[model samples]
Structure formats: structure tokens, C-alpha cells
Target: MSIWWSLHLRREAASVPLARRLLLGTMETAGVDPDVSYDLSVALSEACANAVEHGGDLHSGGASQAYRVTAYLDGEKCRIEVADSGPGFPAPGPGSAVRRGAVPGAAVPAVTAESGRGLCLIEQLADHVQVSNRPGHGVVVCFDKILKWREGALLRVS
Candidate 1:
């Protein structure tokens, strides 16, 4: 079975949980394992929080105030993407080939740092992660995880 959904949400703190809850509900209904659902939900929350805090230009007065979350469950994998409407990540310097966005093997934030841990946590939870800047637009965080269905899953892939 294949399932997919997308949410266009305002960049607000409350929107984070809303997106997370929707994802959990969808996974629950589709019979995803509770532990797997929980992990993704947490990752989704982090992504949404990032979008809420940094997805807009506070001083620009006209920057978009919305972000997007999209999820896909197909075959044996589930993929989630959170995209924000702020300035994209700065271009990586010549010697920093993979430093633009958070890749799985990239350096993680220091433990005592106050912020910037969301991407690192995402890298840990998802099987594969890719962070990219959309030219002339925002940044996108995309992640995928192999699925493990419950005993009697409704949408289990054979």
C-alpha cells in the first residue's frame, strides 16, 4: 500500500504538535508499530519547531509566514519532509562540501549548546536524511526510515 499527505501550516508554535498528532494518527491507523511511530513523531516535532522558529524573516515584514510538511509511506519505507519559507541555508564554502545542510554523518551540535540540535536528532532517528536549500526559496529537511508494521497491520507491505 501507498499513502501520502501534506500539510501547509502557519509558522506558529502550536502548529508543531498539530502536525505531529496528525502524523501519529495516520501511522496508527495504518498499523505502524508504536515505537516507530513515536520516533517519527518526535523527529517531526523537532522539524516543525525549527520551522516555527526560523521559517520566516522577522524583520522583512513581507516574508512568507508558512511552512510545509509532507509524508509518504510506500513499500517498506516512510519518508517525511519539512520545508520552511525562509531564506535557504547559506552556500557552503569551497572546502565544506557537505556543510550546507544537516546530513546523516555531519557533525552534531555540542551537547551543551542551547539550540541547533533538531537536525542532529533527526539524523539519528531516520535511516536516511537530506537537507537541501531550494534555490530562490527555503530549506527542506527530508528523512526516510524503513517501516516495521504491527502484527496485523492494515497497510503492511508484503
Candidate 2:
């Protein structure tokens, strides 16, 4: 049977570490290799940070500014999902204003200066990254990584 784990936390930046810990623990329990575990942890942390910074206005909802993290192991792949509670932004398109070398008119220079590289890093680490708006609420980032199976762990057929 496939194993699934989930966590929900505030969208505050401080909660990023907590989210990473939860993801690491879940991956360890599922027998994920250490290298794969590290990659997943870093990618998830970056995604959470992005959601908190740009997904919506956290102060408007006060303590309600929270995000949800869910992870699961499906055979040789690990799946992770992070959902936030704010109006979502458009998915960054390749060579788009936000991603291109030029700064977009819509983005505030200060915020971009601090954390704009998150999506770029996520793209590098994760095998697949998907972004979508959570109907009526915020945005969801889903990512998947292929797990490397260890040799000799499985019995050979005669």
C-alpha cells in the first residue's frame, strides 16, 4: 500500500522550517534515499516560502494565513503538495516577465529582491512542478521526484 503524510501550518515565514522537518520525517519513514530526501526537503521549503511571500496577504487574515502540506510515496515516486490560503498569482511562464532577465512592472522590486529565486531553484531540484489555483482560496504547488531504489533490497527470481 502507498504511504501518505500531510501537515498544515501558518503561511508565516517562520513555519518554513517546521514544514521541512515534517517532509523529511515522512520521506525517511517511507525509506526514501538520503540524497532524494535532501532534494525534496529543500524544494518543499522554497515552495512554502514563495507561497507565504506572494500567494496572498497574510496580515489580512491574521492567524488564518496558513498553508497545507501533503506528501505521499507511490511506488518509485514521491509526491508533495503545498496549498496556501490567499488569492493565487499566475503561474510563471517560461521567458515571462517575472522569469525573464527584465523586471516585471507588476512586481515590487523589494519583494523580488528578497525571494525571487525560489521558483527557479524549485525548477532545478524537482523533476516535475505544477502550480494551480485552489478554487475560492489560494494556490497549490505540486511536485514529484523519482526515488532511487536500492539494489539487493528486492529478492531475485530464480
Candidate 3:
């Protein structure tokens, strides 16, 4: 069965875990591999947390002021996207092959900061990760995970 969901959440600290829990529940009910679900949940939490921390304009709930999380599940593969409404990341240099916004495990200049490891953790956990900024609107973080079940499981997707 195909399962999907989308959430529009206030850009607050409390919303981070809420988003994670929703994803976990969705994956569990859909019979996803536990380890894969866990990794995706962690990655989703980090992405949501990043949106809360840097998406900006939390006090206002006006249009284009909240963060969005969307998840899609089809058989053994799951894709999730967390988008925000803010000024967005800086433009990538023309000569650069991949935009900083769409990079995987890209070195963050704010490594010395208290909480700059989200993207790195996501890259380590998710099977695929892509980030892109919407020029003055916001940033979108898209990630995917492929589930693998242990042998002898009752259900396995080819």
C-alpha cells in the first residue's frame, strides 16, 4: 500500500519531536523496516530542527511563515521533504557543480557553532539527500531511505 502525509507546523522547538513521532508512526504502520524507520526519523528530526532554528519569523504565523514536512511511502522506499519559509541559503557560485543548498555532507562553515551538525547527521543516516533554496522564499530538504528486511520476515518488498 502507498502511504503519504504532509504537515504544516509552527516553527517552534516543540514541533521537532512531533514531526519525528508522526514519521515514525507512519513508517511503523506501513510495515517498514525498523532500522530504516529509525534512521529516517532521526534525519527528519534534524531537518525539522534546522527549519525551526534557522527558518526565521517564528512569532508570526502568516502565510509563508510556517514550516512544512511531507512524507511519501511506496513499498520499501520512503521519501521525505521538510521545507521552510524564510530568507533561504546563499546562492551557489556559478562555477560550483552543486549548489551549497543541494549538497550532501557539505562542510558547514558554522561547524564551531553550538548546533551545526544537523546536515552532516542527515547525510550519514539517509540513503539520499538533496537541499535547495527557493531564492528569498525558503529552503527545502529532501531525503529518501530504502528499507531492507531481514531474511525470514513475513513481508518483503522486491
Which candidate's lDDT is highest?
A: 1
Query: Mind giving the per-residue lDDT tens digits that candidate 3 earns over 12-129?
Result: 8899999999998876666677898899999999999889887977676674557999998877778999999887765545554341534533445553678767887888898888
Best by TM-score: 1
Q: Which regions of candidate 1 fall more than 4 Å away from where they truly are?
A: 58-63, 91-108
Badly placed stretches (over 4 Å) of model 3 are 59-61, 91-101, 104-107, 150-158
Q: Score candidate 1 by lDDT.
A: 0.83
Candidate 3 lowest-lDDT run of ten:
96-105
Q: Number of clashing pairs, model 1?
A: 0
The alpha-carbon lDDT assigned to residue 142 of candidate 1 equals 92
Tens-digit lDDT track of model 2 for 1-158:
46787787877788899989987776666566779889999999988887778666756775347778898777788888988877666545555444432222223234438556766666688898877765457777888898864444331111
RMSD of each: 3.1, 5.2, 3.6
For candidate 1, write residues 1-158 as lDDT tens digits: 89999999988789999999999999999999999999999999998998888787756655458899999988889999999879765554555434234643344455697997888788789898888866457778999899899998989989
Comparing 2 with 3 on TM-score, the higher-scoring candidate is 3
TM-score of 1: 0.85
Q: Going through the candidates in order, what is the number of backbone clashes in each?
A: 0, 0, 1
